[model samples]
Target chain A: MSVYTPLNEEQIIEILSNYSIGKSGVVDGIKEGITNSNYFLKTSVSEYVLTIFEDDNVNLDFCLNYMEHLARKSIPCPQPIQTNSNDSYILYDKKKLAIFSKLKGQTVSNAKITNEMCSQVGKVLAQMHMYSEDFKKNFSGVRNRDWFLNTYNKVQGELNKENASLLDEEIKRYLNYDCKELPTGIIHSDLFRDNVMFQKNTLTGVLDFYYACNGYFIYDLAITVNDWCTNSTFKIDHDKQKSLIGAYEQVRRLKNIEKKEWNTMLRFASLRFWLSRLNDQLFPTDGDLTTVLDPDHFKNILKDRKNYSDKLE
Target chain B: MSVYTPLNEEQIIEILSNYSIGKSGVVDGIKEGITNSNYFLKTSVSEYVLTIFEDDNVNLDFCLNYMEHLARKSIPCPQPIQTNSNDSYILYDKKKLAIFSKLKGQTVSNAKITNEMCSQVGKVLAQMHMYSEDFKKNFSGVRNRDWFLNTYNKVQGELNKENASLLDEEIKRYLNYDCKELPTGIIHSDLFRDNVMFQKNTLTGVLDFYYACNGYFIYDLAITVNDWCTNSTFKIDHDKQKSLIGAYEQVRRLKNIEKKEWNTMLRFASLRFWLSRLNDQLFPTDGDLTTVLDPDHFKNILKDRKNYSDKLE
Candidate 1:
C-alpha cells in the first residue's frame, strides 16, 4: 500500500468543498489499495475514503453506480458518498475522485482464512452477483482472455522451455475456447483476499470494484477460489475451497457446464494472473513506486493445477 | 509513508489480548512515521496507534516515561496505553511494542501554516519544554555535533569542491564554538511541521518523540523555526518566525545568550540535517524501504542561512 499523489490539507479542504460533509479533520494517506491513491478522510462529521483513480480509463459511472446500486439492495459495500449537486464523482486535478463511506472490518490474509470466513466470502460473492444482475451499465473486462494471450506472447521468450510450453498451451487453449457461451453477468473479476474484509466469521465489506465487469460468473468464482484457497506453496487448501464453493452453491448453484469445466476455469484463472505478473515484470510500469509481484508464484500455481488435475476433481 | 512490517490479523489479535482495550476490530498499517511500524488500531472500544519500535536500542523507558510524564501534566501528547500487567511497553516478536491513545487533528503542511497556527505551535512547544523540565531521563541527542562531524567526514569525499568547502567551514565553526553553555533540556530534536498536528485554531497533538533528547531548548526552537518558517526556495518567512518567537516568549522567554546565538543555532540545525541526509546518500541503509530525503534541500537552507546571516539579525 502506497500513496502516489501527496495531496495537502488545503487541497483536501478544497476537494471537500463540493460535498456537504463537514470540514475535514485528520486526512491520513491509506497505503493499502494498489490501483489508486486512497486517503482516509476523517472529517468533523464522518470518516470516508477519498480515492483518486490512477488509471484514466477507470469507468467512474460503472464503479460508482454499481456500488450505489449494491447499497440500495442492502449489500455491504463502500457506498459512494455523493456531492451537494448529487454527483457521485468529482474531477480533481483532471482525475476522477470519489469518496466512499469507510467500511467496517479488517482484510484477512490467505493464511488466516478459516472455513467459516471462506463460506462468508463465497456467500457475499454470490449475493453481489445476484443483486447486480439488473445493473444496466456494462464495462468490458480489461484482463480478459485476449489480455492473457497478448501478455503471454510478450513474456514467453523470458520463460524457460517447460514454463514457455505451459504458457503457450494455456494461451492456445483459451484462444480457441468460446467463453461467451458460458453464463454472462457482472463479475467482481479480481476478488483477492485483500479486496474483502472480515470480522470474526462474518464478511463485512467487499471492495476495489474497479475490476468489476461483464464476464462469466464461473470465471469470477474461479478467480476468488484461486486467491482465497491457495497456500504459500501454491497448493489448494481443500477445506477452504470446498467451503467457498459449497456456500456459493447454497446462494446460486453452479450449472452443469460450470461443474464440468471447473478445472479449466481454475487453469484459466491461474494463467491470467501468471501472464499479467510476467508482463509486469517484463515491462515494468514507470512510477514513484512500482511493486512487480512475483510471477513465479502464479507459475507454480498453474503447474500444480495442471499436474494435479484429477485430484482437483 | 510506508509500512515495513507485515503483521497478520492473528498476530494482531494475540497482541491485543495482552491489553485491556477490548476487542481489536480493524487494524490498518499507518504508513506515516519513518522510524517505526505503526498501525492505526481500531477496536470495539476506541482507536489507538500501535507502534512497534523498529530499532532495538530505542530507549523505550525514557521515551515512554517522558510521554507519560508530559501526559500527566496535561500536555497535548499521546499518552502511552498500558497493559493488564501495568506495563506500558510489550515485548512482541523481540520488538518493543507500545500503544498510544490516538490523538486528534491533522498535520499541517508548510503551505498551510498560518500566523495563528505558528503562534499556537510555538506556545505548545514552549508548554512542552516547560512541562518536560521535571522529566528525569536523559537520552543524548543522537544527531549531536559529534554525529555531524563524523557523518560529514564520511560524505565529504562525495561532495563537489564548493559543497566540500561549505561542509568544512561549518564543521570547523561548530567544533570551535561552545554549545554546552546554552539552556539544556528535553528537546524534540526533529519537530518538523508534519510532526505537529492542529485543528481549526489550536494545536491538538505533538507526535513522533523518538528524536527527543537532552539538548539546547533554543536549538530545538531553531530546528522548528528553520523548518516552519522556510518557503519553497529555502528563504525564511520573517512574519512566521517572529510570530513563533513572540508567542514562545510569552510562555518561556529566551535568554540573552540564546538571542545572540540564534543565527548560529539556525546554521547548526541546517548543517545537522544536511550532514544526515548526505551521510544517508553516501552510506545507504540496507532495508526494504529507505527514504533518503534530498540532501540538496538542507544544503540550500544552510547556504542561504550562511549568506543571509546579516539579514537574519
Candidate 2:
C-alpha cells in the first residue's frame, strides 16, 4: 500500500478550500490501502485521512454514501467528510480525492490478535451488516464470481503443479455450489486484520470499505475468519474462531442454510485471497510502497479448508 | 521513487518546530530518489522540498554543502535551507531530514530532446564541475570499483547467456584501466535525464545529487552524454552528443588523456546503470510510486557502447 498520485501543497490547499477545514496541515503519505493513495492529514479542526482512488473502475457513489449511512446508524466506521458544496468527493487531475474522519486506533498485527479482539470484530461485523441492510446500494463486489474465474486464469501458471491442480479443482468446486438460497446483504467482502482498528482491548473502528458490496453475509464472515482466526502457520486458531463466531451469533443467529454453506464459504474465501495474492506476486504493478503478500499463505489456508472444514456451531 | 517513511501532521509539526519557516503546510510525497523519501513542501515564505534519506550509508554532509556551494557560484542546483539553529539537517527517528529551495522547471523526457537542449545541459554540467572544484570535500562515490564487482555478482544470473558473457567481459576490461592520470573533481555520477530539469529551451535546474562525489571529469561527461544523447533504442544520437560535448569543451576543455579514455568511460557508465537497473528489477523494494526501469535498457546501452565506441571530439 502506498501513495500513488502525490498531492503538493497548492493542490491540497485547493482541495481543502471547498471544505471549512481551516487550511491543510501536514499531508503524510500513509502506508495503507491497496488500490488507493492515502494520506494522514490534520487541520485545525480535526484529524482526517485523504484518500486518492487510483482505480476508476470501482463503485465510488455507493461505497462513499454507504459508509456515511452505516456511520449514521452507529457503525464504528470512518464517516466521509462532505465538502462545503456537499460533494462526496472532489476530482483533481482525474483522480477522485475524498477525506474521512480518522479512525480511533491502529490496525492490529495478525500475530498479536487475542480472542477478545476477535469477538469485538465479530460484533462490529454483525452490527455493520444489520445497519447497512436498508442502505439500498446495489454493488456486486469487485471480487465476485467473474473475478474468481478471471483471476484464476491469470495466476494459474504461477503455482506449482500440485498447487495449480488444487487451485483448479477448488475453483471448479466453488463455482458449482450455486448458493442462490443463502441470505445476501451488504457484506464487508474483504475484512482482513489490517482493515480493523483496535484501541486498548476493543475494536474501536472498522476501516477500508472499498470492497463492501451486495454479497452473502456468511461469505463476509468467512473472509473475516480467514484473516482473524488464522495463525502464522496458515492454520486456524480454533479458540479465536469460536470466540469470533460465538460473539457474531449473539447479534443475529445464523440461518441453517448459512451454517450448512459456512465451510464452503470459508473454502471459497481462502481461494479468493489465494488467487489475488498469486495475481499480485506473478504480475504486480509498479508502486512506491506496494506490499505483495505471499500467495502460499492463502494457498495453505484454502487447502486446509478444503481438506478439513471448520464447524460454525 | 516513493515515500518510505510516513509523517503524520503532528509528527511533521514537531519536525517543523525547529525551523522558523512558518507552520507546516502540505507535505506531499515526491517520486524521486532511489534510497530516500522526498516531499514537495510549501509554506507562506516559499515552496521547498523535504528529503528523508533512507540509506544510512551515504555521505550527507559533503552532498548537502556541495549543493549550497554550487548554487552560490551560479550553478543551477538546489540550495539547502538551514534550520533556525543553523544546522544543515535535522534528525527525526534516526533519519536525516533537510529542506531545499525547489528547483525551477520540470525534468524532460528522453524522446523530447533537441541539440540546443543538450548543449544547454552540457554548459551547465561543465560549469557545475568547475564551480565545485574548490569545495574541497573528499568523498569517494558509493558506486565505485567494489560496487561494480558486488552488483555484477548479484545480477549475473538474471541475464541471458550472451548478456552475462558480455557483462563479464566489459567489467574485466573496465577494471584493468588505470585512470589515475585523468583530472579528478566533483562529478554528478548519475546524471540521468530525470536529474536535469528544463523550462522552455534552457536547462533551469539540476536535481538529485545523492550520487555527487569526487570522480573523473570526462567520466562524468560520459554519464551525462549516455543519458542526454541516447534515444529510447539505447543508441547514441550523434548530433546531440556532438552539440553537448562541443558546448562543454567551450566552458572547460577536456584533457588528451580524458579523450583517450572517453569510450571506456562510456562503456563503464553504461555498466553502472545496467547493474543498478538489474538490481532494482530483480530485488525491488516496496514503494507507493516506485518506477523500476527495465534492466534491458541499460543492457542495450552497454552492448552498444562496447560494440561501437563513439568519438567525443
Candidate 3:
C-alpha cells in the first residue's frame, strides 16, 4: 500500500472511456509499484496504460509533455491517448489522469542484461537528451540537491547526529564544488531495467517518466547504466558499461568536462540514491507500507566513490 | 538548518553545566546534522560533545547503553557525561540530549586511507561483534528484509515500471533467501572514515551510534569494508577488500553461509546506497542546504558490484 489512495477498477474504466479512443476491455491493476496506481489497459482499437497521478503533479506534467515531444521526434515511447473531445488529458476527481499506448514487450529482470540492450538504452537516452529546446520550453523544477534537502529535512529526525553531519558535509561539498554545465534537456531520471521494455532482442519502449525533468542529459545515461549495467552487487560490469557509454557517446560525443566529471558524477549518483533511501527508511508517511531499504548497501558505493574521486585527482 | 530544532549556545551550556561534574564555560555549536545536533563544549576542566537526538529515541537510548557497555569492556569511545541528577541524558524542550567527554583526535578525510587502517578498523569491528551475552542482552533490534522494502517504497515514484517490477521481484527473491543467523549484538551501522577518529596511527575513538542496531556480525565486517576499503577510481579496492576481510576473519571466522552471503550482501549494500542517494537527489529538503550528490556514482558501484559478484561466484 502506498501513502496515497488507490483507484479501483470502475474508476479506472470510467477514466479510460473519456480518452480519445474508448477502452479495449483490458484493465488489470499493477500491484508491483509503491508509488502510483498503474493499470494495464487495452481497448478494442489499441492497447494502453492508464496511470493516475498519485504524487508530484508538476513532475507528472513535465513527464507527460516530454514523452509527447519525444514521441514526435521519433523516439519510441508510449503516446498519450487524448480524450473523446481530443484533449490530451482529463482532470477527474482531483486526479490528473492520462492514458498511454501499451508498450509491447518484456522487461529484462535477471543478470542477463546484454551489452546490446545497454547500448540501445544508452542511444535512446542520448537521442531523448538531444531535445534541448523542448525540455527548456516545457519543464522547470528544482535541481537534484534541493529535492534531496527538502525530503531529507522531512525525515531528519530519523537520522543520527553523525549520519546527519556527514550528510550536511556532503551537501556543503556539492555546493562548494563547481558543477560542470552540460547540454540541458529533459532527462529520464529513473531508467532502471524495469522502466525499459524489450521484445526478444528488439528495444520496445522507455516506460516511467514521473521523474523526468530538465537537467543534464548525462544524468539519464548515468541512471540507465546504474540500473541496467550492474547486477545485484556493487561491481562494475566493464563490458556493459563500455557498450552503454560507447552508444551514448556515439550520439552526444562526451565533452572534456563531462568525461572529467564522469567518475565524480557516478559517485554522486550512487550516493544520491543511498541518501534518499536512508531518508525514507528514517521517515515514513501514512499509507506507505513499502519496506525500507538498507542504508548499508550503499556504504561500499560511498567508499568506491571516495576511491574513484582520488583516482581522478 | 535541519527540520529538527537545534539547541542554542546558551541551552547547550546549560545542559553541559547541568550534566557534567566539571564547570561548563563556552558551548560552541559544531554541526547540525540530519539526525542529531552536535556542539563542542569546553568546561574549565575538559572538553565534551553535546549531542541532541533528532530521531528514534528508543534506538538512541539502546545505542547509548550499548556504547557504555562497550566502554566498560575496554573499547575506546567517548564516555557519557552524566547530568547533575546523575542521568546520562535529559529531555530538554521535548528532545532527548546527552553530553559526552570529547576525545582529542583528527578525523581521516583524505583518499590515502591505508590498508593498515582498513585492517585495524576491520579488527575493531570483529572485536565488537564477538561480544555475545551482554551485547545481545542489551540490544535486540533484528535485521530483516522489511528494512530494505521501506527504502524501496520511498523512491518508488522515481522508478519506472520495469525497474519497479524488478525491485518487487528482487524483494521476493530476497525473502526466499534465508539469511545466516549469527550472534545478534549491537553493530555500528555506519563505520565510515569520518566516524572513526585517530591520533597518529592509533585509533582514538569510534563515533556515530545512530545506525547501531542488532544485526549479523558479518554484516558489520561488510559495512567496514564497504566504507574503509576502496580503490582510486572509487571501485572497491579489491586488494584493500582482501586485507580488510582477512583482518576481520583473523578475529571472527566467517561461517559458510556468512561467506556465501558476502558477495550478495556486498552487491545489495552498494545498491542500497545507490537507491538511497538517488532518492535524496530527486527530492531535497530546506535545512538540507548541503549538496545533492549525483546518482551516477552509485550506478558505477552497482556495476562494480556485478563484476565482484561474478568473481565471487
Candidate 4:
C-alpha cells in the first residue's frame, strides 16, 4: 500500500485521453513519489507521464503553459498533451490533471552525478534562464523576499530564542537591503539534481515545475548552484561551482549588481531551505513518508553566508 | 503588534504566581515560539524564564520533570518553578505553561562559535545523555522519529514526487538499520549551537527541552555533531568534528558499535532536518514570523551523506 493517494488505471487513462500527442495503452503507475500520484503511460507510439495535482489550489494551468513555453523555446522539458477538447489540462473529479510526453532518461542520483553531468545540468539551467525573458507575462510566481518571509513565518513557533532573533535580523537585513532590479521571467524554483533527467552525461529533460515562478534570473542560478553544485555535507565543490557558474554566465551575462548579489543570493537561497525545514519539524503533515529535515543544516549555511558576505564583492 | 497572541503582564504574572520560585519582577513578553511562550522575569535574588506551553496536547509535564531531574543531578539547566498547587505546570485559559530559573548567556552564532565552544557543546550533550538515563520513567516527552514521521505524513498531499521518494527511502533505511541501542534515555533531539548558552566558551546551560525524548545516546551526539561541527557551507570541519567527538567520548565512552553506526547516525540526523524542512516548504502555518527553511539545503546534505556514508565503514 502506498503512503499517499494511489491513482487507479481508469483515472490514468481518463486523464491521458485529453493529451492529443500520445495514445493511452499500458498505464503503469511509477513509484516515484510518496506525496503525489504519478503514472507512466506507454502508448503504442511513445511513453508519457500522467500526473494528478495533489493540491487542488496549485495552479496547474499556469504550469502547463510554462511547460509548453519551455518546450517551444528548445528547453528540455516534458511537453503537455492537449485533451480531446484541445485543452492542455483537465479538471477531473475536482482534481487538476495533465499528461505530458515523458523524456527518455533517468533521475540522476548523487553517485551518478559526475562532473560532466554537473556541467550539463548547469548549462541547461542557464539556457532555461536565458529563454525565460517573457515569462512574467505568461506566468508570474512568488518573488524572493516574500517567498522567504512567508515560509519562515510558518515555523516561527518552533524557533528558539537565538534562531528567532537571527531570523528577525536576517529578515530586517533583506527588507533594508536595496535589491537591485533586474530582468524578470519564469524560473524553475525547485530545479535540484533529481528534477533534472540525464542519459550518460547528456541532459534529456528537466522535471518538477511545481515551484516555477517569476523571479530574478539570478535567483534561479543561485538555486541551481545551491542544489547541484554543492556536495552532501553542504560544502561547495570549488571546481563544480566554477564550472556551473561559467556555463550560466556564458549563456546569460549577469549584470554587475547581479554578480555582486550572488553571495547574498546564495545565503538567501540557503536560508530559504533552512527556514522551510524548521517549519516542517514544528508542524508536520499526514501520510507524508519523508523525514523532517534538520534545521541545523542551514545553520552552517547561514554561518558561511555571514563569513563570505564580503567575499562575493 | 505581534504576529501571535500576546500574553499580558498580569496574565503572565497570574500564571507564574502558582510556581514556588522566588517572586521575580516580571517583564513584558520577550519572545513567542511555536512550541512555547517566553517571558523574562527577574527577582530580587536572580533572573529566570517563564515558558508557557503553546500546545496543551504535547507533554509539558514530562519536559518540566526532566528539567527538574537534570537540575537535581547538578546539570546546568533552567530549574522549573513549581505552581501554587505544587504542580510543575499550570493550565491558564486552556494553555499549558511552566516557569524556570533563567540562565544568562549569549547564543553561539557563527560569528561567536569557536573550536573550544564546539568542544564544550559536545561535552554538555554527552553529560545530558548520561544524566537522562531515567528520562522516560521520570518525564514522558516525545521521541524524534515518531514526531518527524507523524508530521511528514500529515502533509504528504502537498509534497512533490522527488521529495516523497526521498522520504520513503530514508524512513526505510532508518527502520532497517540495526543501531546499537545504548542506554535508552532522554536525548535532546535538538542541541544546536543556538540552543546552548555560552559565557566565554564555558557552557552555561542547555536550553530547549521541547524536543527532549527517549532515544539512543549516540543519536544525541549525532545531532550535536550535525549542528556544531559544520562550516558555513554545511561541510563538516574535520578538526571541529574530531574535537567534538573527542570531547563527547571523554564524557561518555563510545562503544565500537556506536562508533560504527556514527556515519549512519549522522546521515539519519541530516535526514531528520531535511524531511522536516521539505514539509514546511509545502505547508505553512498562519501568522508565523520565522522563515521557512529551504528544502534544497537538505538535498545538498542528502547528497553529501551519500559520499560520506562509505567513510563510516
lDDT of 4 by residue, B1-313 (tens): 1344565667655764664233335555764344456777653323567666665556666777777656543356776654545566677777776667667577665455677887777777776765554344543345455666686677566767977787778777876766546555678888986678876566778888877877777777877887777766777777888787777766667777787777787788888878777666776655453667687776666657657762331
Q: Which regions of candidate 3 deviate over 4 angstroms?
A: A1-13, A23-26, A134-143, A154-157, A160-162, A231-233, A310-313, B1-313
Q: Give the better candidate number (1 or 4) by lDDT.
A: 1
Give the distance in Å from residue B206's predicted Cα in candidate 4 to where it truly belongs: 67
- Scored against the native two-chain complex, candidate 3 gets a DockQ of 0.01
Model 2 lDDT per residue over A1-313, tens place: 6545566888778988866454556688887678888888875444678888888877999898788665543355776766666677898788888888776678886448889988888877876765554565688878888898888888887678998899889999978878788988899887888888887786767888888889899999999999999877788899998899888876656899999888899998998888888888888887732778888888889888888867665
Error of 4 at B45 (Å): 71
Name the runs in model 4 displaced over 4 angstroms.
A1-4, A16-24, A33-35, A136-144, A310-313, B1-313
Fnat per predicted structure, each in turn = 0.00, 0.00, 0.00, 0.00
lDDT for B226 in candidate 2 is 88
Q: Report clash pairs, candidate 1.
A: A1-A31
Q: Count the backbone clashes (under 3 Å) in each candidate.
A: 1, 8, 84, 52
Quality class of the docking in candidate 3, CAPRI style: incorrect
**DockQ, all models:** 0.01, 0.01, 0.01, 0.01
RMSD of each candidate relative to the true structure = 21.3, 24.1, 31.7, 30.7
CAPRI tier for the interface of model 4 = incorrect
lDDT of 1: 0.78
